[model samples]
Target chain A: MLETINLTKQFNGQVAVSGLHLNIEAGEIYCLLGANGAGKTTTINMLLNVFPPSSGDALIGGLSVTENPLETKKRLTYIPENLALYPNLTGAENLRFFCGLSGLQLGVTEIEGHLKKAGLQPEAMHKRVETYSKGMRQKVGVALAIARSSDVLLLDEPTSGLDPAASNDFARLLELMKDRGAAILMATHDLFRAKETGTRIGIMNRGKLMDELVASDISHSDLEQVYLNHMKS
Target chain B: MMSHLFYFEWLQLRKTWSFRLTALIVPVIIGYSLLLGHQRVQDQHAQIQELLESEQTFYDDLAERRRAIELGESEVEHWFQNPGNPLVLAQFGGSGRYVFLSPKPLAALAAGQSDLFPYYGKIALTNRSAMRDNALENPVMQVAGPFDFAFVLVWLIPLFVITIGYDVLSREKEGGTLALLQSQPVSIQKILLMKVLFRFLVISGIVLLSVLVFGFLLGIPIGSQAVIPVLLAIIAYIAFWFALCVLVNWFSDSSAINAITLVGLWVLFVLIIPSLISLFASNQHPVPSRAMWVTDQRGIQQAVNEERHTFFESWKADHPEEVMDGDTPDFYLIWMQRLLTNEVIQDRVDEATERFNSPREQQVGVISKLRPLSPSMLMHHWMQQVAGTDAQRLQSLDGEMREFQKDWKGYFIPRFRQLKYFSAEEISQIPRLDFD
Candidate 1:
């Protein structure tokens, strides 16, 4: 589980994320909805401990992200929106490299299994990622997350620019991960996918979280209207 | 953990064809350049041999002419008409005691001082004047230095190190994977250590292997006794560059910035520092003015010319048995005057030369003290010394040549005094100059 208690981030005299509060419990998928520069990525970056929080703290499993970052990192896996990996390596090889860095020693068979579970094709498993499609590359990133055995997955726009079929596959994969006890905190712009896949949704605008609601609290038909209204005010 | 990092480095090299190409090509380029340099030095050694042979011939011709003159022959004057005679060209080779230097094993690795300094020189007999430098070389080429192994190791290898390793951590930041990578269970410190170790191994391996190959190919003499010091120097030189790379990498996380800064460091420590030091050292330790000594000594001869009648009168006054009616022989007086004039010229020139070379020695001393600041320079200087290309080595040669020049004068002056010659055995007895 992860939590950001009054988390704040400032850059060059401007508040990028201000006084934000959130909690992600075990097996829960919390989608942070926002427009461009709505502090969604900033919140994720702070929570991931990429940069120090300006005024507050990001906590992972009760450990402060700033003071105990390595411990916090051990419990989490991050997949950036534009996941840059060694394109010269095969998808399976990239997974193995990251897994090895995290102190895991997966054999050839295990590496293949993780790749397949991430929805990578059998033929593409051995092919260099430089020749991979965006969807395929994202699957490799997901494979690395799975390989790390992390309890929390921080995904930045995991389904952005994915075709419908690939996006659906991604949502199913998230569900599978959630069932496996890995809490997911995904920052995304796809409201409809949020309604379809996320357990809870939070709307954010101008560095502040406007509202959080359970999927059951909002009707699917009116979710867009509610999200629009939240954005306007 | 070390092995893992090394494996990843190997994998990265395999994956990136460009990096592999650079690593492979750089060493070959460096080694071949050194090969060409060695060949050049060998050629110079051959030329020195030919010069020595010609010097022998000149001496033989001088002795033959002097013997003929003693035999009471007038037709033998034609031998003195040619400029190729030792009596004519003997002084052209500087007045110094000559010492010959043989190449050492590590000469191939650095060729440090050897390229700039002449291998042969004549050390002065009296230390009156500075020994004539007269190294067998083109001066401009000496300044530029040869494209040798020292050049490759000191300057070019660092460039390769920067190109391959400077972006080790920075690329992750640029690609947005730094955060992700850091999120793993690995310690950042451990990761950095592994990266640096991998680079060190790769570069050091390349350098060591190339040097080993050159040693075998060039056949530089090292009979197990002197090999360790040579190898140790090579390793220390390589480590200097490796440590520099680590320090520079720690300061910047941008590959571009790292490359530029590292190159700047290379230029500063390797190229700029040595050159500036050389310049300041020369200014501080200035060489004595040989031309001015020649002028001053020539003035002494002019004084001798004015007092010629007085010298003849004095000789007649001392040697009554050889004088008829107190009139000394014209030939004997002329020979005495030539000998006395030669002595004055030698003394004045030697004094001025001593003044000129004093600064050069001081400059060398100052440059030597700067060795700790730049190990490459130390290695370079040592290697050149070993290869007989150092100026000091040439100075030693000059020292020998000066002794030989004195011998030339001694052999002729005594015979001229006795007024005797014409034995073929005596013609062959004239001492020939040896390079060593």
Candidate 2:
């Protein structure tokens, strides 16, 4: 579970994330919808404690992220927007490094297992990531998140560069994680994908949370209308 | 967790072409430089041999003429002053001072101090000042510089460091993986340390291997005791660069900017500072005029000879014990008396000139002492010292030859004046003017 209370962030006298209050529970997929520079990334980054909030707090599993980042991080997995790993390393190696950083000491065979499960082809496992395609690299990122097996997953635009098929596959992967009782908070501009995969969607604008709605309560077309309206305001 | 970190770092480095390239290029460059330096030394050795042969011939001709004087050959005395020996003019052309060349085993590594100084010198009697500069090579070549192993290590290695290390962490930030990596259970500091250690291992190995190859290819037999200090220098230089890399990485959020800043710092430290210090030292303590010293010594010797001739005329008036035999003509009296007179003047002039050159010698010493602050300068200083081509050894040998020349004068001057026949035993015992 992840939650934030009136969290705020300021950079050089300019506010980035302000008065953000969110409560999320295990097994829920919360899509944070926003336009570019809407502070969705700032809110998610603060929750992950990559950057500290200027005012208020963020908590992961009842532990404050600011005060106990290590513990909070221990319970969380993050998939960055670009998912950049050491380009010199193979997909399997990238998975191993990030998983190891998270304190998972899996052998080569076990690493290969996670790579296979994350939809990376076995043939590409040993090849360096300089040879890997964008979609394949994303699979490696997903493998790291799954390998960590954290209770919460934070993804930033996880499907922004993927094709429709890959995006569908990613949504299914999120569903599988949710089924496994991992709460996920994703910040992205893909409103349709959010409505498709998310349990709850929050529209954010100009460092403020404009509105929150249940994805099932709105039609897919209406979801865009609500999102556009919120962003326009 | 430690094993995982190590393995990942190893894997990352294994696949990075840039890291591999630096490792390979640095060693090859160093080894090639060593090879070239060794070849240069061999060529210089041949040239030294030719100069030595010509100098030996000049000394032989002088010794033969002195032998004629001991044989009661009074007619040869007039010709002795003008030996007209081709080798004398060609080889003893700058005789009067000696320079010693020492042998070195590892001079090929840098050819450090050898290039700037003389390896051989000429010496003569009676304080003749022409011998001070026997090896008259081009000065510009001495200063233009040589591309040796030390130069490559001191100047080029930092550039390789910047290329391999500048983007270590900042690139991840630029790529948007920093947040994801931080979100994991590991400490960022540890991760950064692993990265730095990885680069250090790669760079350090390259440096050590290159040094070893230099030793092998050039036959540079560095002592076992010297091994540790050489290793220490390499490690310290590398550590300094790595530390700079880490500190730059700490603040900059982009890889490109970090590279630019690191390269800029490298230029400032390696190129700018040394050049600036060298410029200042040269301007502040310029080498006291060699030309002036040469001219002054010559002028003082000439003045002493003239003064001694006057003293001899007064002394001849006071003493009849020095009267020439009836067979000796007045012109011969004048020549014989003036010759003896100039000997005293020669001795005094030599003493005065020694005093004059002492400050110039001290100036060279001061400059050498100040060289160590710059590692490049220190390396060159020690390199020449070891190679036996440094100024001190050369000048000291010249000092020894000056003593030999004085002995030569003592043996021949009296015989030439007395016109006495030398017995076989006395002729055999005449000391040979040998220079090593």
Candidate 3:
């Protein structure tokens, strides 16, 4: 489980994220939707302890991120939009290295298993990431997350550059992770994907949460209208 | 975690073409340097051997004459030509011994000031100036300096280190892996430290192996006391460059910036700083002109010539008991007057030489104090000292040579003053220089 209570972040005299509260339980997928500068990534960064919040706190499995960053990091995996990896290393090698960082020593076969589960083809596993597409690199990121078997996953625009087919595959991978009882917080601008994959969607505007709704309770068109209205006002 | 990081770093380095190239090139350069140094050592040995052979031939000729005279040969053309005369023997029978400073076993590793200064001196019974008779060498070669092992270790190794290490962290950050690495359950500082340590070990290992291989090839005694100081110097110099690389990488976010900064530091420490220190030391303590010393020696010789009559009269008065109503041989009187006049000139020459050397001593003192400012300078000094080619060691040898010359003159002056003729056996028993 991951939670943020009254989380706020200020840069100099300006507020970037203000008074945010969220509760994501195991087997939940929470997508943060907002325009640029709407504090969606700020919220995820705070959750990852990339930076300290101005007030309040983020907890992963009930452990404060600021007070126990190493412990919290061990329970969570982060995948950024670009998913930068060692270009000289093959996808399987990158996955193994990350897994080692997380203190997991997986055999070669097991690493291949994680890569296949993350939707990377067997033939592409041994090729250097320098030749990998953005989608393929994301799959390696997913493989790393799966190898860690973390309870919480924080992703920042993970599907921004993926083609429609790759994005669909990524959505399916996330759904599988959710079914296995992992809490995920993803920040993205893709309203359709959010509606298709996110268990719940939260709309943020001007560093504040403007609205939130369960995906089953709203149509994709209606959520888009709501997000546009918030951006205008 | 550290071991895992080291493994990954090793994997990457093994695949890096630049690293492999450096690893191969360093040994080749070392081999070339060792060969050059070995050739230099051989030249020095050959010169010393030639001088020794020439001196032995002169002694052999004198011995032949002594044997002929002992066998009741006809009288020589003059008494002074007699090999049995103590004065004639001292003058012509190899009394000008060559005091040669043999090259140390590892001297080829660092030529140091050995190329600038004479390692051999001819010490005769005359009061000639010591500064005028240095071995002739090509001035341009001395200025260009030898590309020996010490030059490679002190000047070039650091550049190789910077080439491999400057981008260790910045490359990761630029590739966007640093963020992913930071997301891991490890501190960034520790990761960078491990990365630097791995590269340090790689470079240091290569440097040590080069030293050992070249030391063996050059016939340097790798287990001797001198080897320890040279090894310590190599370790410290490599460590300094590694630390500089890490510090630059810590503050730089781009590979280009890291490279520029590290190379800038290399130029500053290796080339600029030592040159500046040398310039400042020389300016502050300029070596007195050698031309002036020569002129002073000429003037003193002229004055000695002018006082020859007075010198002979003083010698006669001091040796009244041996004079015996003006019965002393003219050869004996002339020899006594020359010895007395040489003593007076030597005192003045010694005083002037001391004054002339004061500035050089001051410069050496200043350089010793400031050597720590540049690792290159420190390493150069260390290698030179270990090779027995440093100025201090050469000066000590010069002092010992002067003492031996004194002993040589002491033994023969009394025999001349007593007007005693030397036998073949007595001439053989004359003091000879032993360098121990």
Most accurate candidate by lDDT:
3
The positional error of residue A54 in candidate 1, measured at the CA in angstroms, is 5.2
Model 1, residue B15: distance off in Å is: 3.7
Q: What is the overall TM-score of model 2 with all chains considered together?
A: 0.77
Candidate 2 residue-wise lDDT at B427: 36
> After superposition on all CA atoms, how large is the RMSD of candidate 1?
6.2
lDDT of 3: 0.84
| Candidate 3: segments with Cα more than 4 A from true spot | B49-61, B71-81, B127-140, B321-330
Ranking by lDDT: 3, 2, 1
TM-score of chain B of 3: 0.91
- Steric clash pairs (candidate 2): B94-B131, B96-B123, B96-B124, B97-B122, B97-B123, B98-B398, B100-B394
Tens-digit lDDT track of model 2 for B1-436? 6667667777767667777788778878878877877787676666666666765665555556646655656335443253332212222344333334534555565555455555554444344332323242776545656676667767788888787889877877786666666777678777777777877877888888778767765666644565566667777777878788888998998888899899888877766666776666566656557677678668866786768767777766775665556796454565555556666666666676677666666656666666655554555455555545566665565556566667655665455445543443343344644444
Cα shift from native, residue B169, model 1 (Å): 3.1
Number of backbone clashes in candidate 1: 38
The DockQ scores of all candidates, in the order shown, are 0.43, 0.56, 0.70
Instruction: Place model 1 in a CAPRI quality band.
Output: acceptable
lDDT of 1 by residue, A20-87 (tens): 99999989999999889999988877776778999989888899988987788888888877777777
In angstroms, how far off is B126's CA in candidate 1? 13
